[model samples]
Target chain A: MRVRLRRQATLLATVAGLLLAATPVAQAYEPVNIVHTEKVQAGPYPITVGFSTWPLRAIQSLDFTFAPDGGIEGKSGTLTMTPATRSTESRKRPLVRHPRKLEVWGLDIRALEEQGDWTFRFRLDGPEGPGEGALTLTALEPPGPPMALNWSLSTLPLIGLVAFLAIAWRRTRAEVLAG
Target chain B: MDLTAPGAHGVRAAATPRTAARGMPTAMALLAGSVLGLVGLTWDVQWHTDVGPDTFFTLPHLFIYAGSALSGLAALVAVLGATAAARAGRPLDPTVGGASVGVFGRTFTAPVGYLISGVGAAVFLLYGMWDLWWHGVYGFDAVIDSPPHIGLLLSGIVTMVGTIMVFAAAAEHRWGRVGTDVSIALTAANVTITVLGLTDVGGPVDAVHTAMAWLVVILLLTAAGFRPTRGGAVIMAGWLAVIQAVTWWFSPWAAYAYADAVGLPVRDYINGVPVMPALMPMALIAVALLIEPILKAARAHGNRWLPVAAGAVAGALVAALQGIQDSIVYTYPTPGPGTLLPTAVAGALLGALAGHLGWRFGHMLRLVNRTRPEGN
Candidate 1:
């Protein structure tokens, strides 16, 4: 009886170990696949750009590449986003039909002035459209502040007065209680 | 005869009976201090930037010149006097006679009142440049609405400062004197400005809106002057409703008129994308009006449902406006998420119901004596 119980326990342990090992492999599997790729070079840096032909049936896969002087020191960038609701039109339309641009906001990049080829390589599981394509865009200097400092400085006195009041109030309150 | 008495300085002279001696001085002092302070603010030849059709210029901008500089000067004087008194060994006689100046200059301090009033007025007036430059109201592209687009970097800073001052005065009750008076004055000014806009005098609506912005400030001051009451709540709600109606109906009319003046046959297109925009402002105003009633009802009745009902009313108003606007705008029944009618209707109904019930069960459950103290 003891030998039979030990054999059953060993079998259970082995099966659990196998399931744990397969978990990552299963999770990594995605429906959207990237096929074509392009690397735009600016000096030493490289920007790898990629896109899918159709809206991904489901985003099943994604990968990124970091080029030297791309301001991102190493291959250490991640992309995460939700897709817009897929309408019937989206299914009927090809990925390249319109400007299917994946707009990324708040990229914490420094030394944008540094000349280097920055490439962003990405993969997506798309609908039955262009499996994948790549495009390159140049980084340009952003525009100026909407209102001039001269315009804003007009309110500085108001700002300063409020600050003064707050400080004075605190001091007076303390003195009044102490006295 | 003794000015040293608690109420002597602030009350009517004994022999004079009707005329208040002390109150008069206090009032005069506040007025004089503010005017003098106004001079002091402009004492320095400061180059005030005005955003115009062209780039930034040192030329006098109406709002910056009038509102910020003048009001800011008044605030400076008031603050200086108050601070000086605070620094002096006089113990800062806040409760002069019968007037109650609460902790940390809560109610009107003579100097503080002047300063805040001036600055508040100035800030309120400065909206002309903002409207012209940001919203592209004068046939400019909508893209100029962006912060970086207009070269007015300090827009955010000025807005933040103004907002803080407005809120601070409201919180500190300095609003009772400076903020309130300024708001009333501004509202009156706005009424005139709107008339000018209606006449199409060929200028930005800054003058009109600058005046209009004072309406909320005045209403708030009036509300604060009175105790919390069903009537006051209703008044607040009514004010909000009026604002909503005006924003919805009048704003559209105004926009259409402007479009017509510019030679665009947009009166019929008013039912288009314009209608959708119209509903947003209306719904916003409706929500503002109903929020207080729901809370008050919830507190008075202890009925958790009162707020819910109020919210439903607000939501219904919003949804109806949105539907009306959408029907005007869209010719085809695009039954999807992006469609204006369905989205606005759903939002209004759900929002009103949820907000009413949520608030009823939440805050605004306390009933204070809702009555206005006759005169300040």
Candidate 2:
């Protein structure tokens, strides 16, 4: 019975050691590198941020993801985003498992107001240690629909005005000449 | 000017005594309704920016509806009154007689302006329905220049133009300078609304286009449509300034407070500060000042080209002055000289066209009022 117990313990220790060895290999696969408008290196981690709506206009949604050099398999953290121009309170959200990506932490922000540089601060506490980092992104003028589309829509009123005036003028001319 | 003279279109004029007593109320109603409509539109824009769209029956919408309803009702009453008097074999009130137009095989008495205004109100109502449906289908518009919005603005412009016509005609009927003053005020208000509605052209980058358009249209209309009166353009510029300043000062705060009250998480900042205030119509004063001398020279020398020349000068001045102001004050990127030069040329051409059109339209209105026929 003692020899059988020793064999089982040895088997469990070998499996645990193998599993531990595979973690770095899995983490080496690198969180999906998203093309981002702004990137920052927070203590031991690289954070990439971008507006989900392209061209980074005002009043748009934001996407932020953090990939620590050591990976996020056993890490916990928080992200705080604040607009530099606004006095509004900074928004704090827990770093959680990204819905779409594995081994990554992310936050999806619904709307950003005003156009300017927004600061993003990240705080992470993990097996390696605790670290902080900040990044700034410049928000642009709210990108509108295509210029052609906007100009065409705006010109409708001018066309209508001109048409109405032409018709009125014709009718009045007819009436005056007849009188 | 004899108030009872037979006007154009075989329409008999109303007796002077009755017109003197009854005209004041109708004129006052038209002015009030049009002005209220302008105010409502301004408020609606504020609501759109601050709170986003809520319901079809918001407070600002009610204001617009009330204004339209009042103007339409007043015009309807005048038409019905004139038709009744005509049937009863009484002299048509000059106030309502010149407005006679045939519709559906019956003679309806309404000033051309009021008729136009009433039609505009009806169309505006229809467009409002379409706007609601559009919002439901495609979602709320992020910008103001939606097709339905453009339709509504065009109708509103027609309504205001009609109001101006009504007052201008009244002024011709010896209603005094007060009538002229009211017309000028309405013109200013119309210009303000037009500028506001065209937000695309009013942006910091596109302000030059707006300035050119404003200078040409306004200078031409004021110079040609109204009788030459010293300071008329100045008064209009003053009115524009006052309306812009007042609305700018109060609208954002009111919008923000309402949003907060409703628990909407709308951001009030643009860049690092509060959203930019409404653009001022200050360049118009320069155009107005230029118009005065041109109008005087045209009247004194009977120069046919003077109106066009005046418009060109006003347009050039507007482009240069406004371009400089926009760059310095708004921090908008300075447009190249190439951009400015073309703007001036386009402004001059447009001004000339507007001058010709305004002159023709103004003459048509005067002729229609002076040739009323007996019995019909």
Candidate 3:
């Protein structure tokens, strides 16, 4: 009887696994979705900036693609992202091959941590020599409720916990001590 | 059943170590959650490495939250039971815990360990909120040393400490030995994880931070040896090795599996070993064995400074082993903006303090049941 039940369970699990495996592919992370683009002429090279999410917001994950005219071949590039908000540090990243796209350089599922204007400075070095250009990106407030409000709502449970501990201790301290 | 545990009459019947230790089962259960969370943390690191920055609601996040929830739930159960026991007009046994602090007009009672664990869970929520905000402001930078991450790791350490204290309080019982030893291993894991954020392995400054963590390990292991039931430190060392093996095996494998299952295969699948706490070589195990003769000598000769000496040795050894480990795994040690001398000095100083504290804490745990409250 136990063996029969075990075999049935195994069969059920396999079916479920197979069903999940057959589900439609989630394009959420694999393919880069270019929702917006900006053009920059780095000396003789004309480079295009592709953003997965337009009107970039702080803390929201998005992808970025930098495709130069003709192709990325015979050309190595570098990216330096500097936020207008001086409070945050600047980041220097090399133009690596995009994971999914494979033809261009991109940052996959990366988020801008702060809301403000950001400068994307690119240096493309290839057969045309080293060409440099910069573009300003304005990142507005993130989607959904304000950050403060979200934090306030998230911390309610912590406050409740503190209050409960206080009340429980107050009512019990006198009674337990005298007992 | 433990002899001193509550009789059939209930928790009110006796003021014994068993009654105090009533929460041992809960504490151990909480440990499972912590271990799960540590696993998730390690897996999460590997995920971030092989895969790029992902959404907040990823599989790793789920595992972390679930583990935190399980730990929080277990601690909450212990607290509620203790408070109910106190409110029912039963004075809590001191060995286990009792009404120690009052909040506003209300006073709650429980074992100190459970109380601290509960507080840790609450603090974790606060850190979670901070982490969310930090991500919004800082973006999804992969480095571990964010303010919120540090806070989260500290809260985790506090939670682990609470577990250790509970077992230490119940040191009289057989359960306490296993509990304390296991707790020691987990705590060491937690401490190492926290230190990793502060230190970059093989870097001059980073190496010192790694070496400084030897203080806690020495203290805990030394404390374990202080118990009537000896060899606990060695057992804890074994647990550390197990932590390394389990994490090393699970992190990369799970990262790949989860990423594949979710339809987002890794961008760069080819990688070196995963970087996480407890994934490194078991340096503490060797240190543990090496210090035994020293600890024994201290006891045998009544030499007060020997434990401190052991701490110093462990400290220096930690620095040396960490350097060697990083050299083998990553690149050769770099002087990255600093020299190695400061690290050596800091390790010795921290080790000396840890040695002294370990002896003190070990003694305290040994005598946990004996030092009852004044009225009790």
Candidate 4:
């Protein structure tokens, strides 16, 4: 009876080892994909955070996505985005969109106050468990038009002014000569 | 105070000095209004640079409106007063008679300068409406050279010129040297404002562009100098210096106080550094000094080309001096001959044009004097 119990225990141990080996492979094969992945870490439970727009720039729209190790199908929580520079205050809102094709939580931001590093903090309480994490990014200003364009636009009023002066001069000259 | 005296063309001559002195209050009101407008404009620009756009009814905007309203109202009152005098068989006061024009089946009268200034004020009011609409559609301008802003500046210039004209005519009356001095000072003030407005385009970094802008400014100043007023250059220089000093002293404090009041984060406050006043005025003053002697010589000789030559020389000096000053101030690379050549040429052309305009304005003054009624 003791020998039979030992054989059963060894068999159970072997099956457990096999399941552990396959767990990572299963995670790798999951449909969850993150583009421009800024950060991926476990916060009690696993979470992936990244910007939707690559190479963040000032005066441009910003889009961010957060996904947990488990699919977002049954997730419920809030995301807060704060500019690290404190030039503007943080914006806090709950996640509502669960795009069927993308299968990830998403948030769209229109414009940042100024160019600098900004921090994004996330909190999620879902069926898998509670999760929290933070990510930081640098916002750069986009390249402007050439110096010539700036010069042309700046000096455009001079033309109108000169024309006005010329017309006034002509009228004055005529009146004087006639008199 | 006998007001009945008919001159040529069925127009009445000016009222006696005693009667005309009553118009001094109206003149003072116009002058005060103009100063308010200038201050409001400068403050508005600074506000935009520091705090970005605020509401349409911002304090600076209200100041500007008040100025226009006051100046326009004063001008209208003067016109109405003159018309009433003329209809009642009284001679029009020279201050108002010189500016009268028949319109809308009624004879409207003010100093010619005030008449033109009032029209400019009306135009400015219309443009203000347009500017608000423009901001709504295209968003607030990141730069100052927008169409509405240009229109506003032009109207402001017209108003200022009218003020100068009114003062000039008054000086010829019993106001004497005092009126002339005030006119000269106002001319200087107007020139200073123009230079300030053009700083966006004529920044010290762009040598050629700065030269071009200064060329135009120098021409205008030269034309203003044509007035038969002594110490024209000194008045221009004094006003420019005073304005610069006041701006440098006040701008930084104002900006800081405003930021603190608004609760703007220290990191977000851009107006901590006081704006550097433009040095182009100093260069123009140098030209003005040199031209004074040339103007005297030209008048003594009755030499037609002398003023033109003087203008050209002044323009060239302004361009060259401004180029050097800009290079030093902005730490810009030395401008090549190519840039210098074009700037010099433009300056010369503008100088000649200025000379012609100056000659014409002087001639107009002479014509007015010739046509005036003989003394009682």
Alpha-carbon RMSD to native, per candidate: 25.3, 20.8, 8.2, 23.6
CA shift of A107, model 4, Å = 22
Off by over 4 Å in 3: A1-64, A70-95, A98-103, A109-179, B1-22, B91-106, B199-204, B207-230, B277-281, B331-341, B367-376
Q: Which clashing pairs does model 4 show?
A: B3-B91, B99-B112
lDDT per residue for candidate 3 within A1-179, as digits (tens), equals 46755775687469547744654444255357798899988878998889877778876767788899989989887788888867554666678766667788788767776788888889889998998999888887876567567556544444543554355445444433332
Per-residue lDDT of A1-179 in model 1, one digit per residue for the tens? 46754774687469547743433321111222335445544333344544322121121112222222223322223222212221221111111101111222111111112122222322223222212222332333222232355335444544654464445445344332221
Candidate 1 local lDDT, residue B234? 39
Model 3 chain A: ten consecutive residues of lowest lDDT: A170-179
Evaluation by TM-score, superior candidate among 1 and 4: 4
Model 2 TM-score relative to the real fold: 0.64
10 residues in a row with least lDDT, candidate 4 chain B: B1-10
What residue pairs clash in candidate 3, if any at all? A113-B137, A113-B139, A169-B106, A169-B107, A169-B108, A170-B105, A170-B106, A170-B107, A171-B106, B20-B96
Q: Candidate 3 recovers what fraction of true contacts?
A: 0.10
Error of 1 at B167 (Å): 11
The alpha-carbon deviation from the true structure for residue A169 of candidate 2, after best TM-score superposition, in angstroms, is: 4.1
Instruction: List ranges where model 2 is wrong by over 4 Å.
Output: A1-164, A167-179, B1-10, B15-17, B50-53, B96-98, B172-220, B260-266, B271-277, B333-336, B371-376
lDDT of 1 by residue, B202-314 (tens): 23222222222222222322332222344433344344444334434433444344333333232111222322122222333444455565556555665645544555554
- The Cα local distance difference test for each model comes to 0.32, 0.57, 0.65, 0.55
Give the Å error, residue B279, model 4.
6.5
- Per-residue lDDT tens digits for candidate 4, residues B1-376, read 1112233224544556665566666666677667677656656655655544344665567767777777787778776776676577666556542545554445443445566667667777877786686555433433445556666666666665555556555545545234434444444444443444444344223444444444344434434443454345445555555755675556555544554554432222243433334443446566667777877776666566766777677666666566666666656686776767666666676666656555555545433312432211
> Per-residue alpha-carbon lDDT of model 2 for A1-179, expressed as tens digits?
46754775687469547743443321121233355546677676665554334556555444445666667777777777788866774766677654335456654333445678877788877776787888776677655455456446545545755775676677678654443
